[model samples]
Target chain A: MTLQMTVSPDFPPAYIAGWYIFNTWLQRQSGLPIHLTLYDSFAAQRAVLAQGGIDLIYANPYDAAFLVRECGFVTLAAPCNRADEVVLAGTQTGPVNTIEDLAAGTVIARTDDPDVNLMGMMLLEPAALHAGNTTAITVDSYPLVAKQLLQGHAGIGFFLEEAFDSLSALVRGQLRELVRSRISVIRHVLLAGPGVRAQQVEHLTTLLLAMDQDDRGQAVLESMNLSGWEAHSQEDTEFMIDLMDTLDTQVLPG
Target chain B: MDGYQTRIRYFDGHSRDALIREHEVPFPDGRLIVSRTDTCGIITHCNQAFVEMSGYPERELIGQPHSILRHPDMPRAAFQDLWETVQAGRKWHGHVKNLRKDGSCYWVLATVIPNVRHGRIAGYTSVRRKPARSRIHESIALYARLREAENP
Candidate 1:
């Protein structure tokens, strides 16, 4: 049977082709027939995941809890020096210069990426913008959230820090960031499902860790906008997953 | 062409005055319809599946703004969300009601992503597939409420 692989939908679209390239490289290196399937949404990806259809995944920290605890998946690796962060921003010309200036009727534009949304909401706490006070509109991507700010349709927006930084300089110039979450421990991870053999996991991990040392591997990493991969021990994985669970519970009721 | 022209008003970049038929064409499962548009949302390429589902020939689609297929029933907020998402260099997924050349409509689960070239977004690519019946129903109700809010 062919092994299946998927990446979290939160990754930038520019890396779509890069993921496919990495998949082909992995298949050749591991000698496993890995089929890469891309999903457009976390909900859609999780639907297949609930049925045990995915054997390998590059997932965000929020989903790591479900994958590791409920699905019997093991942490394989994480990108080096990359941590998930959230940025709360508004149009440079908007009245809200800071989070404290956010008002009751403020329209907060955000995406369905749970962790980023949660952190963004927490950042809004100082302004007393609760579920009852603010209007939240869910868009499909970070760029859309920024669009809401740019068009004066929304008073504020939530974005993944990486996504915000990736915005074109021209667009970024039009917005001012209110705050950014520095929860450096929460990072995306690569994992192997229960179906993956231990030997295969070890070999795959070895190849990934050495990716930055070779020229071709380095090029693939650059395409994905990654520096390199670092081996994630089970203990560190559990710690990060536990932190995500705690953060989930701490978010204000919406 | 007369039937199509009579039913839907062709505009340069906006189609807020298009007619709605209250009809929905069910998108076929396992078939993916694909199209590409320039940064300004003008059609650059469309696949055979897109042509069939849209009821427009390739010649008719090329050089037209993507809004040409915009159905009247689709809320402005939905398109705003789609535009914002793709403009940010990210992928956006949503259920869309599209108007065909014959003035009929179809519902598709659409995924649109920016086509980045040389560190800049040159255009966008939208790949659409069959939407779940349940999602279509939810979208209908949700879009109705959103449209009401917009006009109210």
Candidate 2:
């Protein structure tokens, strides 16, 4: 059977293209008929997950928790990058230095996508008044969040630390990190759907975890900005559970 | 693009709990660490006490995931039970040890209530008070046992 492997459109189009290449290599090595799929938007991905269309998924912590809670998906392994984090950034001269500095008058800018926005929300919630004064202006991309900050259209910007670093040096020099959501091991995971067989799941998990030991797999991991995959542990599940609770509770009673 | 902005407002209350210290800080009497989260546990509103007790500035805590204060020593089972109880629309109360920015710890007696809106659970309200020292001690031992169970 051709197993459907889906991915969240977390990265730019170019990196996603690399994911397809990695998928082809993995398919060959595993001898499993795996077809890679990517969604343009989280809404599209949600629809796919809801219908149980995908056999495997590469998903972030928040989405992983959501899928496990609502869709019976199980994480098989988590992929790690050298430095995994999400941060809130602002121009060095911007009046806001702390989360409290983002009071009513301050404007917050972030991407409209849920995958990123959810992290923004998680990081921002403790600072966001269960009820209070802060406005979140959603743009289409991380670059736009930076643009909004640079142009003085927004007081605060939310982005992945790497994405912010990818900006020009001059732009990079202009920004200061206000606070970071430093989940030490923040990374995406390979998850199995409700329909996958346990033996196959175990086999796939072992193959991916040992990928870094081989040459072809090392190349794929390098292209994807990953060190390697590790077996899922109970701590991983606890982290997600806490994450889900955090996301659920951000909105206070009106 | 022409600039467009939206405004959010918060009520003000000034209160400071115990400061972060190297030793375990007991929750101050009458000082409560309270916060509300959407059904998923993302903090929305927190009283000044919650921010102060966490040893994190108020602004940093507002839009953060509640797990931002998760102490590594905390067992997953405690939270799993909390979620199961609250998700079922029941009030759940327990003792919790949370980590502060400086790595110090504090214990709180937390009661989580499902906030209902229009006959459905809108979110949750977590009100935490100073837990009794005896309860804190019991929790410490129990949590240690739970962690041992997990590792074993």
Candidate 3:
């Protein structure tokens, strides 16, 4: 069967072509037939996943836990030194300067990115804001989240730290960072499903680890805004998953 | 005939109104009505029990928003809590009143969980089973108050 590969939908949209290039390179190196599918939303991607249509995936931290625990997927690699973090921001001209300044009824613009939204909500706990007390407006992408804040449609916004940093300087300048999660252990991971043979997983892991040393691999990495790939041990994966579960339980309903 | 026509209105392409039979479809014991939806609440899959309980064929349920089965009497805040809990990757349990295609309704104790793929939430799976009639009565009264508060 032709192996199906997909990346988490939360990746920066500009790097979409980069993922395709990477997929092509992997197929060539492994001498295996691989098809790359891009999904517009988490729900759309998940529809296919429910049917067991995916074999290889670049997953976000939240999904990683599920794939590991429920789907029996094994970690292949993770982006080197790239931890997923969330930034809570507001318009520079907005009255809320800190989390403490936020109050009930604050309109929060965000994407469906689960982990980022979870962290953003946690940051607001200090000020007693939550899903019940505050209103949440979901947008399609991080840029749209910024647009909502800039247009005064929302009082604050939740963003993936990488997405926040990649915003154009003009837009970035108008936004003031209220806070950012400092959790460094959580990061996106590449995983191979249970159907992938052990030999194939080992071969792919080796190829990924060597990508930074070659010119073509370096170019692909640069396109994807990745420094390199590092092997993620099962223990490390379990630890992160546990941390995520712990965090999930700590969030109390408003 | 004119008065009867006035009692019928449309909902989800089916005519429903105050005069539509208000009755219960008692959930089958020892069976679960299972359905899956994408993160956006679009139904992706449903089991035979769900189809039977909902009075909707598999074709009608799939690809439709889960809200297609939402009874008008169900309070909005209850769903809000469900969404908030599942979006955070947590499980939620509650009693829900679900409308069937024929305009009848059923009560179930429902549990919903977010399905994760590659470290991100992809969809949700909801498994519902028979709820005690006493518990259903409690929900009925509680939801009535909640609906009143919401509308007021």
Candidate 4:
């Protein structure tokens, strides 16, 4: 079966390269071929997966929810995510470290798609002041969010940790850490199409988990930031149902 | 377009195909594509992946100008600068935006080098692959913006 699927283009070559290495390891272990069709964003991937273009996917945590519920896919494995997710904020003076320090009516900046970004924040629990308090400004890109922050147009920028280092470092220094989300990222996830043989996925994921125990396997795992795999699909059922309940999207013309 | 007749080799004067097969990029996942030609533009050889990604039957590309895939939106100055750099026999690495046969665009992290061997200038060789998302987003958007400005 074609393992082709969509993935977030956020991380770049490192993210794609990691998949290449993992795919190679899996093939050597299971003797099966896997291919991927990567897209620029989770939103883009989700649209295609919904139409049945992908048999497997490498998705983020919140994105994984959409695929599970909306597309009827099953999650097989979660890769190691970065320790930090990301925060969006503009210039701030003095020490405003806690989430409580921020006042109401503060506008937290975000992208056009709230399904991934906002849902992730909900999972992480932003400052209560953020509830019914903050207004969201629709921006097209992260750089625009950065622009809003630099121009003092936005109060906070909620984004991924992989922001351009210059602005990322500045935010870390200048803004209050209103919400330091643990970024329960699914640095990588192994997924399968709806109604895929459970045993096939189970067998491959079992090989992925076993890689942590041996030496050569550890080399590939370490180079790839594999912290070992965990099984959690049944647990994801409710979130999946909830995700489809809320998010509506269209496929991007490729 | 007997660009191949104008032979020059930048490194060790080998044909483009030979260099590609042997040049193990230091980055294990890194890939390269090279070809030989004269000081003028003409294609002699191409690496395996080059043919695959360009989506062109190999024969269609070998005798054509490298600019065949130059999207109408690419900056002429980028090409001009690239030519200038390779002519100086210095290697340059940067991101490039190219169009596929079907007109879909993909960004490549590209490196271009001039062929210089035995005190004579030969042709040029380029290596490229899909770039990181951050770089792809920044580079493609910026290049297109620059191209529009140049045309305007």
On TM-score, the candidate that comes out on top is 2
Candidate number that wins on DockQ, 3 or 4: 3
lDDT of 3 by residue, B19-51 (tens): 224777776633557677889899997878888
* Clashing residue pairs for model 1: A144-B84, A144-B85
Per-residue lDDT of candidate 1, residues B1-152 (tens digit): 22223333323333345445555686653345777788989998887888988988999999988988887667888888888888988777777889886678998767777765547887877767554455677788998998788768
Cα lDDT listed for each candidate: 0.80, 0.69, 0.81, 0.55
Instruction: For residues A1-254, write the lDDT of model 3, one tens digit per residue.
Output: 78999999999988999999999999998998999999998888888877889999999888888888888899999999998888889999999887778877999999999888866775675565668788999999999999999999999999999899999999999999987766667899999998899999999999999999999999999889899999899757865775565445333331
* Model 4 alpha-carbon miss at residue B23, Å: 71
Q: What C-alpha lDDT, on a 0 to 100 scale, does residue B117 get in candidate 4?
A: 42
Alpha-carbon lDDT of model 2:
0.69
Question: What TM-score, over all chains together, does every model reach?
Answer: 0.60, 0.63, 0.62, 0.48
RMSD of 1: 20.0
Ranking of models by lDDT? 3, 1, 2, 4
Positional deviation of B132 in candidate 2, in angstroms? 24
True contacts kept of each: 0.00, 0.00, 0.00, 0.00
Ranking by TM-score: 2, 3, 1, 4
CA shift at A78, candidate 1, in angstroms? Answer: 0.3
By DockQ, who's the top model here? 2
Leading candidate by lDDT: 3
DockQ of model 4 vs. true complex: 0.01
Q: For candidate 1, what is the DockQ-based docking class?
A: incorrect
The order by descending DockQ is 2, 3, 1, 4
